[model samples]
Target: MQKIVPNIWFDGTAAEAAEHYARVLPDTSGRVLMRYPEEGLPDFQKALAGQPLTAEIVVGESAEDGGCRIVLINAGPEFAPNESISFMLNFDPSRDPDAAATLEAVWAGLGDGGEVLAELDEYPFSPRYGWIRDRYGVTWQLILTHPDGEPRPFVIPSLLFCGAAQNRAKAAIAAYTSLFDDSGVGMIVDYSTATGAVRADSVMFGDFRLAGQWFTAVDSPEPRDFSFTCGVSLQVNCADQAEIDRCWEALSAVPEAEQCGWCADEFGLSWQIVPEEMGSLMASPEAYGAMLAMKKIVIADFPK
Candidate 1:
């Protein structure tokens, strides 16, 4: 299992989205979809009856070349995807000769019933690039990589600090890298002007590694109607209970946001600090039932 996975929440579209991604993207595969159990709380059971609970999907040629495994949930409409967080797809021609064609095909599929954020065209940074929010409202940034530059992961989760969170991207990056081992800051481009909607010294674009996994972040001073929500969360798989406890103490900031192993950091980003063994334990109904009653997971409570 991947140490870190991006979890997406949808309003009954998780299965559909996962299927579409598997069908359109190269080297992609969708796993079996899971549904809400019939025995859950009456309200939850009635609300989510027979609805898709989770959908797993893998993207990229292989793990060695920066593949990504994402989990999706068909939760209710309590939240929706927004530009606050997006996924960046790096199409390196050096790795794949057909990178351009692949990018265009992907753009077409995702653009259907979607809005374009940036038109696909030659930018100073790359020959082909575009940003779009798919029909499901999830944003994606596609860029044709400079063959001469160092290689990056095929898919990287990106964070956009806007509104009240403006100018906090660098701090968030530093905080995250410090909490996880094998982490460090990467390329950072700071904003030049501090006037109007731009904040000087704020991150214009940057990348960082947390536990060897790459992620991107940017600071946007523009006001928006949306902010971070539980609709999207980052899951950190821990090796042991000690690791989980340490991360829980370090990342958790909102006492009211703690539930079922989920916590909200100071930046308002959600994280799931889970033991790697929890996956196996979930196969047992008894263990699953026990987990539903706790905030910070207790390994001892689950059966071996």
Candidate 2:
């Protein structure tokens, strides 16, 4: 299982967004998991009666076999996705001869009713690259992978440290590497050494491995009005309550933001420190009730 899964909050379009990705991307599929109670919902969730409570979207293969997995959160419109967190889709020409064509097709599909942040064109970094935000407000960076570079997963979550979080990507990576097992920092390119517009000490591109999963981070070269939000959170599936406690103690920074296992980090990024058996525990309405009354998840409180 992927130790860390990206959780995306959607006002009411998680299922729709997942279906759209399945259609536009290759080897992708989405399936609804648990749903809200038929009745007796909290005031904030009354609007989501029979809709999908959680949808598991798999991109580029299967999550069970170690592929890219994302959890779609069905919640209210209190939050919306922004460019603070964008997904990187890598199409390696060496792997697929039609990688370029496939990139074009996927770009066209994602462009439907969406806005392009960066045009698809050849750049110093990659021959084909572009950045776009889908109609649902989720952003994606598509690039035709360099043939000679080390292979990376088909999907990798990319973080943009902007606003007050500038020049903090390197520190964040160091902190995360300290927490997760089998983790290490990958290639890093600082602004002083990177091409294009230059600045001294800021990270232009950096990647890291957290519990064996890959993620990329970059310090925004320009100022932005947005920072991380609960809409895009990283969910760490713990093996037991001990693991959850350890992670919660380390990553939870914003006390007021703690709710049902969701918490904000020092960098304003949100995270969900949940148990591996979350699905089974949530099957019981009593467990669900117990959860809402708590902040950090407690396995003992959840009755089977």
* Tens-digit per-residue lDDT, 1-304, candidate 2: 8899999889888888888888998889888887888777788888788779888778988433556989888877889889999999999888789999999999999999999999999999999999999888889999999999998988999999987676689889999999999999999988885333335777899999999989999998887778999889999999998999999999999999999999999999999999998888988867767889889999998876
Candidate 2 weakest ten by summed lDDT = 193-202
| lDDT tens readout by residue for model 1, 41-135 | 45754777657779988999564854699998787788787888899999998888999999999999889999999999999989999999998
Q: What is each predicted model's overall lDDT from 0 to 1? A: 0.85, 0.89
| TM-score between model 2 and native | 0.96
TM-score for each model: 0.94, 0.96
What is the lDDT for 302 in model 1? 83
